[model samples]
Target: MPQTLDAAAVRTWCSLALEALGREREEIDAINVYPVADGDTGTNLYLTVESAAQAVEAVFAAHETGSSVPAPADVVRAMAHGALIGARGNSGTILAQLLRGMAERLGDGDHLAGALHRAATLAREAVAHPVEGTILSVAGAAAQAADAFPQDAVRAAYEGARQALDATPGQLAVLERAGVVDAGGRGLLMVLGALVEAVTGEAPVAPVLAHVRHEIGDPGLEPCAAGGPAFEVIYLLEADDAAVARLRTRLDGLGDSLVVVGGDGLWNVHVHVDDAGAAVEAGVEAGRPYRIRITHFDTTAPPREREQVQRAVVVVVPGEGLAGLCAEAGATTVLARPGEPPASGELVDAIRRAHAREVVLLPNSAELRHTAAAAAEQARTEGVRVALIPTRAAVQGIAALAVHEPDRRFDEDVVAMTAAAGATRYAELAVAERQSWTSAGVCQAGDVLGLIDGDVAVIGADLADTAEAVLDRMLAAGGELVTLVLGEDVPDGDAVADRLERYVRDGYLAVDTLVYRGGRGSTPLLVGVE
Candidate 1:
């Protein structure tokens, strides 16, 4: 039985697409040969779909508070907006545009064929120089097929996409020479197949790529040729239509494979350029750009024989200073932004990037326990020995890192690090957002909150006063060392640390104090006693 194109179907489509992409990511990456062949098309598509799925979930969560469910328009729009902001690479950026186009039509109550046609048009328009036999061509074919068979649009579109994917090698000279289909087109076909399953409750037959199993040096299977752009630059920009138009012209002159996708004053910009700095500068001139990422094309060695380190530490931190501190300690650091926590895939990526035989993962938050465990399990399946130390806070992770000895036996090192983290007690100072009752007492908005071991233990009107009271409470049990991490937003942070250090020195006979800046997005202060 065929399902109607509604909010539920859209949700199912995102889920199925993400799952399919996850299973096919590595295979897709292995076949990537065009547009510089950094070999991350599958990963990019997976991440983009993941973002869209998360956004759709967020909508459902918000609606759970009420009796009514979200409408199809809301769900589709959220999916498109999420993909646009989280889009990565050239293929991912174009996919975002395609989703946006479909959303524009579907939200307006257009049929499946009309939505597919709009998606194909918008995706082609998003690319600076649309080429034949790319994802765009496959998209056009899917739209045409959908139009021709409106009664069975989803299945027809998927079949059309599979045919286009098979014909890609014949249409693109590079793909033909490499003996592989267009990687982007292949990924899009998977997405369409997922849609077919979503609408009709039946999975389509998977398409097998030509020469997919061929080795790097196999006859008729040429590897990705070198010598293209030095860097791939991407950024999210907040700009008006006029500014984006000018930016498109400026970027077109700077590099090739340019893709600018988004609307309603926000855009995702991607381009491959020799002068990476100039590309970024152009974005700055156009609008306020942030979350900028620039990747050098020549960083990794060939996948076959890359050497792995004996041991490595991967930790999550809350701020730039902490990231820098952990990096200096020879650990790979993942920055956990205030509202956006890293997904398990990101952790898995970090584990791979560490490129070590044995890895120690410190999530640095109690909330990330499941996510960390999942990543560790995934890494283990890939043959990396991963030890997850359940450090509930950054301070605990710091203590664990302090005791990490990579030269020691893996088990011994892990035991020592775990013990060190378990022995440390962490607390933080935060401002109250609203009036609420706490373990200590009823608190009003604008009150300073002192949390000890994840509980609100004290509340005051002054930062210094609240911090001192919290420190006194934590030190009552007797501690040898006091570690203070001050946020960048705190006023007179240096003076506060100095005052607290003097207070501890004068009060305690032999206890020591060390202070560090947590930089932006940190709590006002974090205190760890050991």
Candidate 2:
């Protein structure tokens, strides 16, 4: 009687799921009792899943006009692929894989018992060492329950997931400390919960997906809410698909809440253009755009300078940890990406959105020095000063954050603060679970990778080797003060430090390292020479 589902149903379900996630998103982040305490876990999951939801909307909308209908199969498949590339940290990676496995099960849109079983089995396989009381456990049990009552109960699948989630804290000691369930697991369950509610005739709770990742912009002087669509401008463009996409992308950097999703062979048209001539010329570069169907949306009769008041913020992350940490850092705006720096337009928009007199960008990854340079150039062109400090690593970003001075003017503090960071060395340890090539040498699965000044200097079978290599480089660079931030996975900070002390026994430098207990990650996990 009941089958896979319809598109309208899916969109409704997706929205409901996002709403539930937004409600309980933080609960998962609070589980870190000690050791590896990074705040981005929950936020990572939220953004990862949110990106998937956004992708679905974009894909579906295009499909409506003959784009492609991505059913359970397409939805999960695209989401998994996108999420994996867009994955932030450990939790985000696992979640992306889980989505991938689920998509495999629902391949070709068979929302039947067999499909459910296949998805469950695939999900279990994705996790190398599956932990109980987590999203995996909850998802596994729900799949099993659905197999048993495929016909008798339609909502059984969602309820099973919820039941499994309820026992999450009991499965992990850390979660028990927080007096809450697993945040990632809860987010997963909540999303599915919405699916259940949708099928059962319960009203779906819609989440605010469109607004969360808005251009960090000055809210403008005021909303056209004093009247209407702000600017009612129109323009016509005659360009190829490539040029149109490029132009569309640039508009994002220039303004806010822009809706310009229409382009074709000859004179493709449609736009709520904020600046008519700029929009038309952007398209005209490739060829000539005519008829431009131009009409400007005017709140002010003569039109006031359409400026948005906002801020730009940059963070260094390797996993979901980046999002959580940035949020806690009092960041008003955030964009999630891993390994590399965000583009020039992304940086410029951030500056404009923040209504920045001078934008401060922290390109935490060392290899991103060039990218930061590009961003700086763009900032300068816009008459906005961009203060970029090479935080080098996420640990460095965290450590340097203590010195952030929002109260001071941009010019004075940019110079003063950067000098402070230049005087210190950034050292961090992460597992070489993935293979990589670097100046450090060929990396293996079990090696503990050591990074110094943003380059891979050591990769060894033990953390001590990597730690020593990173420290030795820092010491050689002649920095008297070194701060080593310890992660959750690391054990015996003092013992490790002592071992290093023995390595450089010929003390020409006072290698004093401070260990702060915290979690560090960027959305793009691969950093430096990888």
Q: What TM-score, computed on C-alpha atoms, does each candidate reach? A: 0.90, 0.41
Q: Candidate 2, residues 189-232: lDDT per residue as tens digits?
A: 66666767756666434322211211222221122333333333
Across 140-244, the per-residue lDDT of candidate 1 in tens digits comes to 999999999888888889888888888888998888877888889988998999999888888998776553537533445443446667788999899999999
lDDT of 1 at 173: 86
lDDT of 2 at 162: 68
CA displacement after TM-score superposition, residue 179 of candidate 2 (Å): 3.2
Please report, in order, the local distance difference test score of every candidate based on alpha carbons: 0.88, 0.54
Candidate whose lDDT is highest: 1
